[model samples]
Target: MILCVLVFVLSSTTLSQQHLSHPINFCSMASTCIHDGRGVCASSPDGCSRRSFLDQCDMYEYNCDYGTQFMTKVSNPCTDGQPDFLC
Candidate 1:
């Protein structure tokens, strides 16, 4: 019984480590490509604000967690038909 408990503990710790060490990325769009909970870097959307943006595309390191919220810039298609207004 003691050995079984130790094995279970070890397995759980390994799993937790794997979960925490995973990389996350930010995709301008949500998809399976951003799976694995790693640090995801995303580029500015089509109609993003250039004054406060990093670049057309960005892939930065980030932590993965349930409490983390990602805000994405969206271009309004009804706008000037160009990547002008951000939604």
Candidate 2:
């Protein structure tokens, strides 16, 4: 049981790193008013809104930094694909 749990943790960590490695460029998307193919733009001049769309494939949040003109994610990409419509 312990071994199984350890393996799961390791795998999950590796997978999470894969998505974050490129660091989705929310700022670029926002500038162009686009998202990961399916994500609708729900960002504001100040930053992301409460109803902002999640990343199409990874389901990550698009966090923006108005001051720096940079963007990031509020959380790690969802391991399990969500919002089935896009999937």
Backbone collision count in every prediction?
Answer: 12, 0
Model 2, residue 21: distance off in Å is: 10
Compute the lDDT for candidate 1: 0.35
Error of 1 at 35 (Å): 30
Off by over 4 Å in 1: 18-87
Candidate-wise lDDT, in order: 0.35, 0.42
Q: So what's the TM-score on candidate 2?
A: 0.22
Across residues 1-87, which tens digit of lDDT does each residue of candidate 2 receive? Answer: 999999999889878753443555645545655345543333233443223345432223234443222233333322332432332
Q: Which residue pairs in model 2 clash with each other?
A: none
Q: After superposition, how far is residue 48 of candidate 1 from its true place, in Å?
A: 21
Candidate 1, residue 30: lDDT: 31
Candidate 1 TM-score to native: 0.22
Please provide, for model 1 over 1-87, each residue's C-alpha lDDT reduced to its tens digit, 9 standing for 90 to 100.
Answer: 999999999889878653322333433223323334332223233444222213222222221222232333332112233345555
